[model samples]
Target: MGQKKKEIIKSFLLTLAAIFIMFIILFPVYYIFTVSIKPAATLATTKIELIPRNVTLDAYREVLFGFKGSKISKNFTGTIEGQAKIEDGKLYLTDGKITGAIKYGPFTGLKFEIPVSGIIFDVSTTENFQGTLKGEIEGLFVLTRMNDDGSIGFGIVREVELTSGDVNGVSVSGPMEKYVVIRNTGKAEFTAVGKFLNSVFFGYLKNSLLLATLTVLLSMIFVVPAAYAFSRMQFFSRDHILYFYLMFTQVAGGLGIAGLIALYGMIVKLGLYDKLPVLSFIYAAGSVPFNTWLLKGYIDSISPDFDEAALVDGASYLQIIRYVLLPMALPGIATVAIFAFIGGWTEFILASLLLTEKNQPLSVWIYLLMGGIGRGIDWSYFAAAALLFALPVFVMFMLAQNYIRSGLTVGGLKE
Candidate 1:
């Protein structure tokens, strides 16, 4: 009775710990999705919220359209003391004391006065004019309307700092790049940013797919035979050579940054520098040691009796490997292939170093969006891209989840 009680208590504690760990792991994913839906105003609030007061799917729009922003008509909302009305292609804040076609935000409208050129003009800070917010401080406000006449502006009733790390870029003279997350302004908002992606996003995606597919194919071609040789066949110094390769996988000692740069330069000299297919060879080369290790362990688990049975039936070594060994080791192969594909998908540094603009993959494209020189980072677009980038791998993993579980134990050891 005592032992049974102790076992139950231990199981209960472990279950509780597992649930807690899962919550910790899943919270950041929840937060990312929330940020995608939350308005720009709520972004500035330091308050922690599991559920957003105002949710907008405009970020999804921006990702698809790559537009700077969606055109605002009669529908917009903001949490402020004043109401904004658009008339005759112009916006009028109930008390904002300004007249303009429209500029970005307080989608409804609120009056704001920023100190400018040694004068407190008390004029509305239109999106046309750059208003510097103290960096990293969360502010409460919405980018109202960027009017037809090409004047951009925003409204914030409460004094709040527009954080740099938040979605809104540093207040600059062109367009409103960031907005708040919570808006009480009762209007249909159009705040998506996908318009920018139309130009090169597809090309980048294509390059990435080509690289990943070829890498997987090449890796499998080389890995399977080598792993089978190591697992099933005995040759001179086989263990020694396998150990050397295992050591190489653990550490590539000589290929520091300088060596990598030199290698890239050589590829450039060989006229391979900007080609997407080059990544296949590079990535396949890198994957060999690990893939061989994984597949070897899996192949070892398949009983030698199968190989001998095939031989007794007059099956050649190649035929036995093809018809018998591969089918049995499908889980390990699938796992390695998925890993190789993801590795290609996320190869930013090497892609950037080796490929030029036209041939660069989506990884490099996202990196370039850091908004180059003084324009604050566009966190919304970045997050949106990250979410999109994650979808393929996530879906693939979910689809292959069974393989992951089945192949996780490669050594044929049963506990």
Candidate 2:
């Protein structure tokens, strides 16, 4: 072949190789996604299917809502100011002020009016205690029966303002505080992503978000100044201190169970065990050394000429760093933040050991999903949880990817 033809062939081959590699890498992820949606009956079929023959979101539902029971009763907890008025034997709630307070359950936005038409089997309550009143919602049909009072029951009840974004066919579980039974017995089955999100798992998600963010903020606080000092200043035992940091990083990595237990004991003594900030600080402490090292390398590559210029302009060392070095080191700072966040986001073993049940991060739940591996286990749920757990990390990385790439590559530039 001629030169141009040969180059074209080479490019074509490289493109094909890249496509093949991408397929090999992503096929398993796609398969897992399919498996996660597969119905319970077809979860362990002998036949292999790239596209599941039957797909149901019960696993994801369980992950989000933590309620796999047939009943779909959810509790709404908050302060309310609305008056429920009875109109034509139908209860209608109007002008209600609801405060957001969810001690339990994933109902952060449980604001609504009980539409007049929603009141079925309308029986007037002498007590205005809507707190634990039970109501049945029959979206499909009306059930009419004679009560002890010899009155005909109003058969069908429906939400006039059905959730603009309601789960297409959420299951009706056991009775709620107010007998608001959602009878979805004859409805079309659909994904319960909404149900899952409005669950306790969402609390775990919130906890992880808080921890990871605090870890990043705390890591920046600890790493930036130290890295700048190490990069720009020459103080007493500076070299020794840098070496000590390097040693600490290595030692922290190699710390075994004994070290963990000792740390646990110290946490107990300090009475900081199971606290979110304590775990965040621990993550930041571990992150600082590596992040400092990374930032130091980036800072070193930027000449001290900027510091000299700032000094000539009557700026102090701190001012020079704040104005000049910090702006220049934005990418490096982002890289460090990414590292700290990933450390906290994915740290399961340490979190489980140090945190309480309610305070534990999503990492604990992620690990629990895989605990049943190698047994009569459902791998689909594990896959789903793993994917969801890694989603935030993926998003964080995407947000900071350019910075990380540029931060690491700056050191490789020619003078």
lDDT of 2 at 89: 35
lDDT of 1 by residue, 177-233 (tens): 233232233222222221232224555677888888999999999999999999889
| lDDT tens readout by residue for model 2, 338-363 | 88889988898889999888798888
Q: In model 1, which runs have C-alpha deviations exceeding 4 angstroms?
A: 1-9, 41-47, 67-199, 372-375, 410-415
Looking at model 2, residue 160 earns an lDDT score of 20
Estimated TM-score for each candidate:
0.64, 0.67
Q: What's every prediction's RMSD, in angstroms?
A: 16.8, 11.0
Look at candidate 2 and tell me the lDDT of residue 130.
Answer: 34
Worst 10 residues of 1 by lDDT: 114-123
What's the lDDT for candidate 2?
Answer: 0.64
